[model samples]
Target: MYNKKSREQLLKEYQKETFLRKTVSFYKYCTIKNPQEYRDSLYQSFEQLNIFGRIYVANEGINAQISVPENTFELFLSTINQDPILQAIQLKFAVEDGLSFLKLKVIVKKEIVAYGIKSHEYDMNHTGKHLTPVEYNQSIQEKDSVIVDMRNYYESEVGRFQNAITPDAHFSKELLPMVANQLAGQEDKKIHLYCTGGIRCEKASAYLIQKGFKEVYQLGGGIIQYAQDQKKYGFKSQFIGKNFVFDDRMSERITEHVLAHCHQCGTKADSHKNCANQTCHLLFIQCENCAQNYQDCCSKSCQEFVCLPKEEQLKNREFENKRLTSLKLSTKFRPKLKGLQKNAV
Candidate 1:
């Protein structure tokens, strides 16, 4: 097993690495007979190769967003291909190096995308046509084509294709129904869909087709591969702004355009970050100035908790635990908005 270390130490070691690395993302939707066994075997193999990133395996499918040293990327691919379950999986390559993740974490979840729909809603056998970047861009020019962004609101806030219809869903569970409702009357239109790495849209396209959409298509490898193809073919990029990602490095700038504002300061910033307070890790965007002033906490409560002496903090945690046990109170943490307190305002 790979030895665990502090996040600070891990960050330092990552900065010290001399070689370049590639960030790759991919997902597969298929029934898994043995999730635990599959996860363990993949973890062991990836650890041996020093591969690092987050991976999710569940009954429905597997999703991965990882970075591999350039020299070892080919080996990594070959190793994954050797596994029968992942052999024919289509991997999406990133456009530029984003230094996406710092460590490898494999988690077992109930569902990979968390759509919360019944199994009968989608058939994996029938999915939308996978169009390359060139094909996708060309199709968008057609008079009847409708393009949609298949990510959440915060993700779309950073960057998206010009004129793409962005659904106002806050979570994956809300995304499908919202998209379906938004395009309800346009079932016969030629629809082009995309997401960060193409996995969500793959299943989404399948669902849409099942819902009676006539012409359904998706960016084969999503924005990441689309960017890569843009460089190779010297084609102008149709998408603008940053591609929000889930990692220590929250986003990759696809273009120089800054299309979003920082949640804290309203500055032209597209960066996204989670609160530094472990107990209140609400995802938000803050400019550098705000981050410095708040010490990366989301609210005053979190800031005060973090500032307490170690012993005091531990005592409070113990007290909180006792309260939960005695009162049978729920211990689940909910994200707090920054400006809720009058003092903060």
Candidate 2:
């Protein structure tokens, strides 16, 4: 049986252990009839090997970001491949290695990527042509080519291919419409797509094809693999700055170029940090000076709120919720405002 440890217990266990490993991220979109059962089996298999990271299984497919012990990496890969559905799955190793996650969590979700698009919106079978890192580099140089970054604004703000058209949309659901609207008149032009680990672009390219866009192409393995491939062959990297990740590290450098600035002091920085205020845990960029000045909060109000006692903090949240409710302001769109932080940075 798999034991579910509390957060404190898990952190304690992680701190007490020293393991040498490399973290890798990968995803695959394939029909899975019994995601719960599949999730359990994977948990049992990986847990025994001390693998740690997040994974999601869905009826549509699976998406995972995991850290594996370098010594047993071959065994880990083989174990996952033992399942016919996951056999020969393409794994993209992170550009930099660290204990990115402290525990293994296999969750069952409605969708792997969580784009929230209707099933009828696109045909995955007819996705865009896959391009290797070398090929992707060449395509972006073409005069008629449109390089679209299929990721959140914050992700692209840190690092992206030169001349890539990063949409202003914040959420994944808003990307299709924004991209479609921007490229409305150039349906015949060559459009190239890229994302964190290629999973987002998989569905995005398919969506564009369904919208009647011709000559669509996607970076074969997104930025992660592109970084690895560039290093393996000593190719000059076209991607500049850090690659924003959804792990503890938050971001990794693919190039020495720092293209973004801190949100507070406007100093050149590429680091992303979550506001320390638990209730207002806004993800934003802050330099060392701002971090110290603001105490890791996004705003002065958030910093003050975090300084309150726990009981007072809870009471403040209750009052805030009531005030918003009384004002008839909906909270559903709060997540969409995350992109604005990047613009402010």
Candidate 3:
């Protein structure tokens, strides 16, 4: 049997199939003796059921985001549950699901969340308290409480909890130190944390506790679960705006609030788009009006470049790189935004 094919072929075949599918995401951090072996085993099992999506396995544990067909969803669950390590894991369903992923991929990594902190620095066994959405909502309302958004600035730019302290770091490596410094003097304050999924907060809350944070709590299952529970329990959602997602949908609307502005015109907008220029696929926010005006480019220069012939476009990239130096290009979207806060953890 042919077990592998190009992504184009796989997607084309998937399009022809009429079966309905559901996307389910879940993660767990525990010791895995042989990640490669486990990855291969899981991939084969999932392949038999025609599951598709990305999954990462590390020595620490497994983090999966997979789409299973409706007919095989129960069997998929039971198959994974048969493995003692992943038995009875809580699965978070996507608010909007279709063909969210094009293919199945099981990768092996060193860390599931990739916070770039030393594993010895924080122990997962001693992680922070996991709070339900209701408990998380009430804790943030307490006096002297600090809510820190664990995702990148772009992810939080579209949606985050009210009164949450969002770090300006662009990369995951800069997150821990930045957050630590931001909360430096507030060691005794009740620290509430959250992420797109709950993975990042797992390590973040643990690190905060090691830094002498007296109390630390994380939104159980992060925003995905919060949105689900809020609807199921009929509670008011304090998290406003869009939840930036990695899938094709870009974001999941948590509430009606649009808290971000279009990067080009500064119009009230929360939708994110990649510059139409394939080489300069810079991610930024653009309203429908600006998206039409700019031809979905991050800048007028990119707009022009994308319209050029393939050969000319490649030649222009060399000159464009010189014009947009590393520093200028990195902060192009926020030329006038205030400098990142300098606080000690």
Candidate 4:
């Protein structure tokens, strides 16, 4: 009923694997009858293929971010392409690959994206116009066009489309409403929305239309596909910097424009890393120098905590746990990973 293997054990197994894997994400917003049954079917197929990543299935369709073994990718694609519900699904492939996911997770969720909107708020059938990268680039340059980044603040901090409005929100549940409020009174404007993949924009464009916004459009396949298209066809990318992802490879560089600074030294850097200390695993940008200085930890305190002996560490952990527990909610998005006390080498 439960995965008994320790995290260390799982990681060792993952590292030992000789096969290659490719990460990709795909989603759709069609009616899915009996989600549990669909979930089980997906689990069986994915498990057989030794796939790893998070997946969500709901009555409104399925959302998946999986790493498929290179050997089985063709058969896997054929299986998905043959499915009536998932036929012709658009997949967003990762630009570069690393340790993507440790295990497979096929979850039964209420909504795939978790926009927290009522059924009346969005009509999936009436989503915004899907525009290709070329079309999007041209449309955005036109008058009365408003581009919005439909991802979290952390995601957009490192990279975004040129002149796009990034909402100051952490998670999806908070993002949609904040964007709506920010774009108030611009209902007639040509609202263009984008995400890592095109999934978020599907419901977002519909939600905007419901709010009386005229002329909503979305990136045909979002940043991942747009970047690939630009490279393949030899065109300048309107999107700049990295595309923040949820996998271990935090981001995939789209354009070489460094848009973010190192959270530690204030140097120009966009690479994100979780603190080496498992307890204070804060996600923040750290430059190569800081990575060496702080030993891959978020702060001096976290670095020191990691250096403590195993026996003494448990006693110290009791006090550390209380402090972290209290600060957990406040520092969820903007953690103590920001300013550090002069990093000691």
- Candidate with top lDDT is 4
| Pairs with backbone N, CA or C atoms under 3 Å apart (clashes), candidate 2 | none
The segments of candidate 1 whose C-alpha lies over 4 angstroms from its true place after superposition are: 1-3, 15-18, 315-345
Candidate 4, residues 21-121, lDDT tens digits: the string is 99988888888999999899888878888898888889988888889999999988888987888888888888778787888888888888777888888
Q: Each candidate's TM vs. the true structure?
A: 0.85, 0.90, 0.89, 0.91
User: What lDDT score goes with residue 224 in model 4?
Assistant: 83
Whole-model lDDT for model 3 versus the true structure? 0.83
Candidate 4 residue 242 C-alpha distance from true site, Å: 0.2
The candidate that achieves the highest TM-score relative to the unseen native structure: 4
Instruction: Say which prediction, candidate 1 or candidate 4, comes out ahead on TM-score.
Output: 4
lDDT by residue (tens digit), candidate 1, 261-311: 877678987777767765455667778887888898655666777798887
Per-residue lDDT, model 2, residue 118, is 83
Q: What is the C-alpha lDDT of each candidate?
A: 0.79, 0.82, 0.83, 0.83
The per-prediction tally of clashing pairs is 0, 0, 3, 0
What TM-score does model 3 achieve against the real structure?
0.89
Q: Candidate 2: deviation at residue 150, Å? A: 0.4
Candidate with more favorable, higher lDDT: 1 or 4: 4
Alpha-carbon lDDT of model 4: 0.83
**lDDT for each residue of candidate 2 in 101-203, tens digit (9 for 90 to 100):** 8788888888887677787889999999999998888888888999999887878888989888988767777788889899999899999999888898889
Please provide, for model 3 over 1-345, each residue's C-alpha lDDT reduced to its tens digit, 9 standing for 90 to 100.
Answer: 125788789779888988898878889988999999999998898989998878888999888878889999889989988989889898998876666777788888888877889867787888889999888888889998889999888888999999899999777788999999999999988899999779889999898888889899999999999998888998889899988777656788999999999988898999887778765566788999989988998788878888899999888888866655553646755332212111100
